[model samples]
Target: MEKSIHKDQVERFGSILLEIGSLLMSYGANSMRIRVTLNRIAKAFGYNLELLITHRALMLHIDDKDDQHSFNQLKRTSPHGVNFRLVSGISNMSWRIVSEKWSLDEIEKEIERLKSLPHYPRIIILLLVSLADLSFCRLFGGGMIEMSIAFGATFVGLFVRQEAVKKTFNPYICIFFASLASSLISGLAVKFNLGDHPEYAFATSVLYLIPGVPLVNSFSDIIDGNIMNGIVRGMHGMVIVLSIALGLALSLLIYQI
Candidate 1:
């Protein structure tokens, strides 16, 4: 009730705020960060906001200074993969909205640009993951043959995981299959006595399946006082690790090696 804001614009304001919230949540910003950032951005435009934040959905209520116009929105999000780049980008955008005093049109345009941003290429990830496992093989006192096998195993597993992501498979299923493929391939080293240490390849190849990001985020959330969100994220990360274990165990069972 401080000042008048146009009633007709309420819907548009709500829509834009909803878009921002949905994207932040989807990109893996912790709930507290998302809530605080969204509230600040709305207030920058002379609005008051309330958010009912959970891990899966963001429910929002916005009221302008006049208190006459209000809007409510519920945005449901699917299980989103971790994208730290996108999360940082969204956080920066929220700050710029306040510092730069961007108008609605400019904000909307910027949001569209952010939404359309491309993820890092799958091929690049495949290469890097392979290289990392190859390094781990060497670190484990493996010979050249073990390193090569680890590289190939990681590459094939990561490729499967990337394809599964593209096809929108369940995360648990993707982790399971990826771990299975990598461990199974690495098992070849032992089957044929292809290396001084075939076991190193087997151990390292599926290291890519560790849900490190989620686990880290879970601890961060917990320390930040969002205990429920932290626990949920922790459980989710633990489940992924368990899936990786299941897949590896299944592979070992099949080979009995």
Candidate 2:
């Protein structure tokens, strides 16, 4: 009975650790940090977990010689909600893994299973905010005055109508507003000769869209030995930077035309 209880406790702890790790991954955490946090969580629960995180899935290997028994027991005891949440979190982190590593059918099924969870709303909101921020930055050439006003507006939108914005404000609307405001500000600056570098105002405004911070974080994650996560994040940062450059070039071309 004592042995059974110990096993159950370990399995429950493992489930929570995996859930947390998955959440962190979705938030762009490096693998090393994820591993360390998992270990810490395991230690707190008086268990030692041998874990591996790939771009596809997280594998938990128990070190005990009787691990097979523990594994089977865990398989039987694991809550469907916990498993569903873990898979959903992984899928959220990287959609590329869906069809290739974890079956698309299975992920979809799990997503359906876990649709009632509270964290789902938070995850959806975060994704929406990130998309909106990216679109806003892309549309505005980094405009100074307009970007400032938009930032304030966005903050107010987030604060006052947090739930409504979370539900309704998709990426395109944010981009449209940002672009309209930026164009107005840029036109005014150009017309009035308000500052020495009117173009610089636009450039400064769109700085929020720059991927420099993500690039730096990716480099740091790699240097710290989270190579897989570093590579993933670094690629995303590079793409964002390229996108910003492309947008700027197009804006310049349009101005000339």
Evaluate all candidate structures by whole-model CA lDDT and list the values in order: 0.85, 0.50
Q: Among these predicted structures, which one has the highest lDDT? A: 1
lDDT tens string, model 1, 19-132? 888887777777778888888888898899998777788899998788878998898976787777777877898899899998889988888787778977878888988999
Query: Model 2 reaches what TM-score against the true structure?
Result: 0.53
- Candidate 1: list runs displaced more than 4 Å: 1-5
| Model 2 lDDT tens row, 23-132 | 55554555676776656544443445777665435667543344533431122211111133544454453343322453334534544454444554654654455446
- Taking every candidate in turn, the Cα RMSD to the unseen true structure, in Å, is 2.5, 11.5
lDDT of 1: 0.85
lDDT of 2: 0.50
